[model samples]
Every structure is written in structure tokens, then in C-alpha cells.
Target: MPAPPPSRVTIAFCTFNGAEHLEDQLASYLAQTYENWDLWVSDDGSTDNTRAILHAFAQAHGHTRDIRIIDGPRKGVAANFLSLLCHPDFPRTPCALSDQDDVWLQDKLALGMAEIHGEQPCLYGAQSVHTISDLTSVGRSVGAAPLALKTISFGNALVQNVVSGHSSLLNLAALDLVREAGVPQDIQSHDWWLYLLMTGAGSRVVVSEREVLFYRQHSANAMGAHQGLRASMLRAMRVFGTTYGAWIASNTAALRRVDTLLTPQARDTLTALENAPKKFAALKRLGVLQRYGIARQNRFGTAILWLAVLLGRC
Candidate 1:
């Protein structure tokens, strides 16, 4: 008998006033080696010609494959993405999260599909090539480091996000898991939220060192490349300021809303973190974090996490 047809993948793409680089991204999708995929775009109040471009692309490709363009929630990036992920019409298939400004490599879908398999919920992420606005290559993204399985725990996910949304693929099981969690109102970062939810719920996360897309660095990027000295200083400021603390608080509350979905260990860890000793008792606060295994991926980040806790910033 002939082999079963490849499972169709759904691209959950979000857009907002991305007229400049949107064409390149759309073209890249069309050029994918794995052609059995549908496009679902949620345009979040684009004031430019973005909607026009999307309509034209849909008209061109709609006959050959499934293509949809829907209005977004107009809240922010995270809200827009969540709307797509939790959409009632979202297909029960592997879903790829996409950004409006990035250009994908030809084999992105093929490589992701090859790595993600089985009945368990799985999230797939790969390295990306960082480039300038003109698509000139700068270097590989910082996510190129080899991922350690031990570092994928819920504790680490609390402080660090190992998955890049643009390069992420969620299996069918993962899609169901997200739907079960439902759409959250205030998510600081959709990718980070996914990492936390998936890890906490005891799902598989596969990361690849292979570069999958061109992560365009431009002024209009929401959370652009977090590299270089300037970016480092900005991050430091956030860590010490109320911003980082706010993000942690928001994410913690969001997880709490779906507390029952997490594994026993993860639920315990979350509770412990919530009940951690006051920051005024620096040593005790740090001890609590250590005891619960709440950590970041790298030594520097872990150190920063401890400092943040001590400073009442976490």
C-alpha cells in the first residue's frame, strides 16, 4: 500500500502593520519544502497595507491550500497569538507559530515535522539566523547553545524561555493542551508562557541547533534581538527595575489559573515559589529559590535571578 499522506501543518501567523517585511515572510512560506500546510493569519488592526497584502496572498494560494485571515484582539502581540492558538476553528494538527517580519528557511516545516512525533504533547524550537533589516546576515541567534534536558523543568521555565515562537512547532497534543489551558488575558510573552505551561504540564520540548529562519532585526520589532552591550544594559535595567518583577507576577498568576493542569511536582514548585520567604530576608529568599530548583538556563541568568529575588524584583 502507498504510504499515508503527510499530516497537514497549520501556520498560526500574527500580523500588525507589517507592510515592509510582510511580503518576504509570506513568500518564504510559499517556498517551503513541505508544502502540505495551511495559513491562518490574525491581523491585529493594521493601519497600513498589511491587510491588502494578506488578502492578495490568500487569493493567490487559497485554491491550492487552506488560507484564512481573521481580525485580532488589538491588545498586543501575546493576545493576538493566543487568539489564534485558542481559536475555535484552529485545526487539530501540528501548529507553527510565526511572526510577521521574519523570513523562513525553505526546509523549516520539513525539519520541524521530522523532529516532532508520537502521541505526547511536544514543542519544537530551533536556532535562527539573525539578520539586518535588508536581510543581510549578522550571525546566528543566541539560542544556538545546546539545550540540556534537565534545564527544561518548570522551575527553569519560570525565569527563562527556551523556545522562540517564530521557530516553534507544537504537535497536535500540544494544541489540545493549549486549548485546555484557554486564552489568558495578560501574557507578557506568548512564547515564554508556552514554555512554562508545556514544561509544567509534563510535555516534551525538542530544541534543534539547526537554523530555521532569518530573524530580522529592525527598529519596528516588538522584542528585537537581545544581543550586544546596549541590549545587555537594557536587560539589566529591567532586572533591577519593576518591569521584570511585574512580568514574573503576571506569569505566576496566569499559571495559577490553570494550576490543576500542571504535574504534581510542578504544582508543588509553583506553590513553594509563591510562598517563598520575603525578599527582605535575602538569604532566606535565595534559599527558597534554591530549594525549589527555580533557575535560569545559563549561569549568568541564574545569578541574575538570584539577584532579582534578593532585590524583590522577581
Candidate 2:
């Protein structure tokens, strides 16, 4: 009797000026325990040796796996990722996103596929060990807590993203779900948008407690880790200032554009949030949030979020 062939996983990797640490990340992929995969890269106008390194890797390893590289939209990180995911040439398969500077654990792909192998739309996210430029472990990221299935709701995704894109995998059904919604306009974080889209469409979001990658934090990180007191203060400031409000507006507008794809409860929650600012009294606005069960992961953050609502920052 012949054993079944292993599932082929598609790696959707995006790069900008990541030549500094790109080689190490690519090496990690080569060392993966799961061998059945192909690489599809989108380079967003790299001014450095990023393109050269990518081409070199493809030339060297193209025989082992199918490697295809393309030009990106050059808008920004969010746009690059969305464009890669929606590219017609990208295969509809079990897919994982890759950051050019991060090193994945040997089992990153195997574990992700094991969890997301399902008939329905499913998104899988895992935690990571934070590392400095030299790959020395600082610690696990702050709020790297395992996500509970109950907490994975559209209401919570409205204000927070628990799914880390670099550590995420989307099954075929989830990929179809994303393509059905099409690429959104003006999204701040691709991961947050994925969280919103998955939960809104009533899909399953499964999380792994295991840390599956080394999330490298460097001076050139497009988005830094939210792991320290300084980072926490910066996040609070964003919540209190216009930045958080702008992000919320972007996400909500994108959701509105595809409301038909969302579940009935998700649509109701979106409407409630859109109308929250119109309520005259702060208490009434807070009541609307409380009624919809919208909250951040922790009480302190949730308190700050409520205060942001009072100040018209959300």
C-alpha cells in the first residue's frame, strides 16, 4: 500500500529592504522539518541587496521547491501583503506568511498545518520568542498569552488583534474567504484585518500556545514588538491620540465595504460601533460597548480603550 502524499504548503513571503537579516530567515526556511512547500515572494522595491539575495536563493534552491518572485505594489507593508495574498498566480492552498527577518522553528509549518487542516474556513496563529538583532532571546512577547476560543469574537477583533500575521496560517477555505472579500483599502495592519475578516465571516480562529518563531526586533523593523514599558506607553498614547482612531476608522470602513460577508451578529456589532460616537453622553457610549461585549484583552487596556471612546479617540 502507498501512503498519501503530504499536503503542499504555500509560503507567502514579502520583502522590502531586508537584506541585512534576510539570509538568516531564508536559512531557517530551508531547515524546516516540513519539506513539502513552495515559496512565492513579492519584493516591494528594495533599494538594497534584498532582490539579489532573493534571486540567489531561488537560483540555488529552485530545484528543491517551486520558487517564484514578483514585484510588489510599493504602497506599504500592508499593501504588499494584501497584494501577494490576492495575486492571481498565488495558489489556493494551506498558506503561511513569512517575515523576512524572523527565524521559524523547525515545526512551524508542520504544527500550523496540523491545526488548520479542516474543511471549513480556519485561521491559525501562534506565539513567538522575541529576539534582538543577533537572535539572542530577550523573552516571550508581552501579552503572548494563549488565545481562548471564546475570546476570538468579532467584537474583540473590532478593538484588538490577537492573531500575529508572521505566526499565522490560513487553510484553503480561509484563503477563499479572503479572496471573496477582495483586497481592502487603507488597512493599518494586515494581521488585524485578517482577524476582523475571519471572525466577521464566522470562521474558526485557532491559536497555539507554543512559540513557533523567533520574532526579530531590530532598528529596521517595520513594526516593533509591543513588549516593554516604553512600547506600552506608546500604544496608550496612540489610543489616546488620533492614530488609534484612524486605524479603527480604516478597519470599520473596510468591513462596511464587505458587510454581506459578515455574520448577522458581526454586522450588528459593526453598526453599534459606528454609531457609538453619536451618543451624547459618555455613559451611553460605554453602554453600547458593554452591550456588544467589545473589549481589549486586559482590564487596564480595556479601561484605556473606554477612556479613548470618551475622548473620541476610538
Candidate 3:
């Protein structure tokens, strides 16, 4: 018997004034080893040559690749990606998210597809190599550590995101689940929300050991790459501030809207997190999170998470 045909992939790329490196990123897409893929982009009102570049590339490759460009919501990066994910025209195939400035390895799509094909409602992600804006090698992205399936859960996603959107691919069933949930207001990050929703719904989440892209860091990055002590300090500040609370509130509200979709265990964990902070003692809240197995990706990061919880910050 003959083998099945390759699964078609739809690459959802969100752009915002990424002209400086857009060509390289697009070129990398054209060089992908996977041939059965299309590109759909939503631009968030770029003032630079981003629109022109996309238009030219689409025109040049339209015969070979299905390329579509549309206007974005202009709310922010997360919103822009959500717009593409929820678009009515989005293909019902395996979908991958793309950053406007990252250079994808030739095998990125192929690798993701290979892992995600047999698993319905699955999410596939891998490590990324950090690079300077000029494509100069810096190092592997900080916390690009191996992802253990045991560590992936709605509880952990509530505290941290282990999945990088740029290197992630989701099967059609996962996409349908997200679209059914709809876009939430005040979402802190699209990738984090995906991780939460997928795991919460008892879907499979796979993180490959391979490195698949150059994660470019630049001045204009909505969230630049940060490593080392300085990065830790910055993360602490964010977790300890009112912003973290707001993020929690926003995510919790969204999760509640789709509460029925989650497994019983995940629903209970979400409820616990929602009610934990109401306790008068910070240590009590921290204990609640610990009981639910909420954790960050790394040991040091988990320590900071515990600290933040103890301070009534998480």
C-alpha cells in the first residue's frame, strides 16, 4: 500500500514594521523543506516598507505558494496573532505561527508536521537559537531546555509558558478548539494562552528536542530576548507588579468562558488558582499553587515563582 500524502500546513505570520528583516524571514519560508504549505499574514498597520515587501513577495511567489495578506487588529502582537488564528478564512490544516523577523530552518515545518501528524489536537514546538538583529549568533535561547511532557499542564501554563509561538505548530483540532474559545480580552500572550487551552483540554503537547529557528532579538521586539541575572530581575519585577495580577485575572476570566472544555482536573486547578489569592496569608496562596503543581520552566524560575506567590504577586 502507498503511504499517505503529507499534511498541508498553513503558516500564520503576524507582522508590524518588520521590514528590516522581513526579506530574510520570507526567504527562509521559501526554502522550507516542506512543500505543501501556504502563508497567511496579518499586518498591524506597518508604517515602513513591510506592506510593500509582503506584496512583492506574494506577487512573486503566488504561483507557487498561496500567500494572503490582510489588515490586523492593531491592538498588539498577541492580538495580531489571534486575528490570524480566528480568521474565517484560516485553512483547516496543521497551523504554525511565524514571527516577522525570525529565520526558520529549512526543516522547521517538516519536523513539526512529522511529530504532530498522528496526534489529533496536538501542539508541537521546539528550541530556537538566539541571534542578534543582524543574524549574528548569540546562543541558544535562554530556557531552551528540553520540555518534559510531565511538566506540561494547565497548572504550569498558568504560571509560565514553555511553548514558543514562533517554533510551534498545532494540529487542526487544536485550532478548532481555540477558535471555539474565541479571542479573550487583555490576553497577555497568544502562545501562553495556546499552551493553557491545549493542555487544559487534555490535548497532547509535544516539544521536540530539535532547534528549528533563529529567534532574532532587536530593539523593536515586543519582548526581546533576555538572559542571565538582568533577565531574572526583569522577570521578577513583572511578576511582582500589578501587571502580573492583571494577567492572571485576564487569563482566568478567559478560561472560565470555556470552562466546560477543560478536563475536571484542570477545571479544579483553575478554580484553586482563582481563589488562592483571596487567602489572607501569602504563604497560604503559595501553598495552593504548589499543591496544584504550578511551576515555571526552570528551577531558578520556579524559585522566583514561589517567591512571587509568597509576596501575593503571582
Candidate 4:
């Protein structure tokens, strides 16, 4: 059932030092076709003009029940975003996250709204128009329902980080699911964490027709493909072996301790880790994995990883 009347979706933005592209993002939101949404700007230790820009936008649209600037903790992106949801002013309202430097399409919220058929939070899967000078979509399609866990985990999610944080939308129930999932302060990215939480929590992740969000790229982004094959490969190796190994190990330990804390669904999802080691080892030992020119993202194998690194850039 779609939400009974009186419900609204909140568009929350978390800013660090995002002055350069903030105005562009604001303009995109201001032009959104859907009218039942609100804009929230939360600043996180920006020494730049992020505040001035957000304040000006809010000043004009704040009272219209469409925009507001919030003062909150300056922790990392994950923490800052949680603060946005936990803000007293932030009701148990539905929300969609926004990054400081991305451009949202006018129909971003409209499509998500159409999918809102119940009191359940509407969590969406977004397709990004990666603007690496020109727009190129990053991966394959998710079909009718983006949140289908079995299909997504089997390969849908394994192939690429298909869900863009800037491209998604969520509702209070979805946020509740996330909080119940207990995201760590040090998880990879908001999108990854959200993917894990949302899918694990049984929230629907839809791929909307809206091609909103131009994921901006510059050297400073935490991660992006603009680093080219060499840098991308190096980072991919570190993430796969050094960084991600440590991460999986840590999350495994935490998951074990918190097994009781998990929803039966979350427990089932995390417990599936029991098969990861054997699966990977079997693939390494028995599967006929072919050799390909290693891109930074090809985290194929440990030996292959070092070999690719030693080859002096892919």
C-alpha cells in the first residue's frame, strides 16, 4: 500500500569541502519535477564556502518546507549521514542521500515517488551518468527490481558497485533497517554500506528511469575510475587483499559477536560468509581462471596482483 497522505521524502546532503560543485547540485534539486520533497544541507567541517552556498539556498527555499541547512557532527561521511538521519529535526521521515558534487535529474525523485506504493520505505537503486569528461554508465542493468538480494549478490553486486550513493533514495523504514544493521564507522563507502544494509534488510532497491546524479570526478574523490588503469589497479589490489582482507576479517569478527543483534535476515546474510573462503579457494585451486591484462580493479589473485603491480602500471 502506498503511504497514506502526509508523508514526505527528505533529500539530505552531507558536505565536507564541496563548494566547487555545490551550486550545481543545488540548482538540480531546485529544478526537480517532484514537489513533495525537502532539501537538507548538513555541513561537516568545510573550510570552504559550502555553508554560505547552502545557507543562501536554504534562505530562499527553507520556509517553503523544501530546504533546510543543519548544523551537525563533522565525522566521516558514514557518520555524518547517520547524524543527518538522527537529527531531531529529521523526523522518522523518508530520505534520499545526496553528495556535494553531483547533479540530480529533475525526475530523480519523481520516479522514486512512483515506486512508493506502501508505508514501507522506498529504497531505490540509481544508475549514474559518470561524467569522466563525458557520461558513461558504469555497469549492466539490474532489471525490474534492483533490490532483489539473491540476483544482486550472485553477480549483480559482485561485478561492480552498481548502486551510487548519490543516485539512491530511502525512506524511514529503510533507515530503520540500516540502523538496525549497525554500520561501522570505517566501512568502505556510503553506497557500499547502504547496499549491504538495504539488501540485507529486505528493503526494495529500484533502478529508476531517472538518470539523475552526475558523479563529479577530480583527484580528491575518495575513489573513482579517473585514476586510469594503473592507479585503479593498485587501489584495487590494496582494497582486495590488504585493505579488504582486513575489512572482511574485522567485519567477520564483529558479525560473530553481534550474531544475536542481527535480524534473522541479516544473520543469514552475514553467516553466508561461511562459504566465502572455500568458494574463493576452490576457484583459485580448481577453476580455470584465465589470465587477462590486470587492470587495477582485476583483483584476480595475490600472485597476479603483485605481478601486475611489478609490471610497472597496467
Q: For candidate 1, what is the lDDT?
A: 0.86
The digit string of per-residue lDDT tens for model 4 on 37-64 reads 7877778888988888888887877787
lDDT of model 4 at position 120: 63
Could you give candidate 2's per-residue lDDT for residues 62-102 as a string of tens digits? Answer: 98898999999988888898889999989988899999989
Give me the overall lDDT of model 4.
0.59
Model 2: residues with Cα > 4 Å off, grouped in runs: 147-150, 222-224
| TM-score of candidate 1 versus the correct structure, residues matched by position | 0.96
List candidate 1 stretches off by more than 4 Å: 147-150, 222-224
User: By lDDT, is 1 or 2 better?
Assistant: 2
Model 3 vs. true fold: TM: 0.94
lDDT of 1 by residue, 85-118 (tens): 9999988899999999899999999999998899
Clash counts per candidate, in order, are 0, 0, 0, 6
For each candidate in the order shown, give its overall lDDT on alpha carbons. 0.86, 0.88, 0.85, 0.59
TM-score of each: 0.96, 0.96, 0.94, 0.72
Between the candidate structures 2 and 3, which one is better when assessed by TM-score? Answer: 2
Candidate 2 positional error at 41, Å: 0.3
The whole-model C-alpha lDDT of candidate 3 against the native structure comes to 0.85
Model 1 Cα RMSD, 1 decimal: 1.6
Residue-by-residue lDDT tens digits, candidate 3, 1-314: 99977888999999998898999999999899998899999999999999999999999999977899999999998889987899998888889999988999999999998888664689888888888877788876556456443487788888777788899999989899888888887888998899899999999998777889998876666354545676678877888787977887888888999999999999999998888764458887888878989877677778877777766666
**Ranked by lDDT, top first:** 2, 1, 3, 4
Show the colliding residue pairs in model 2.
none
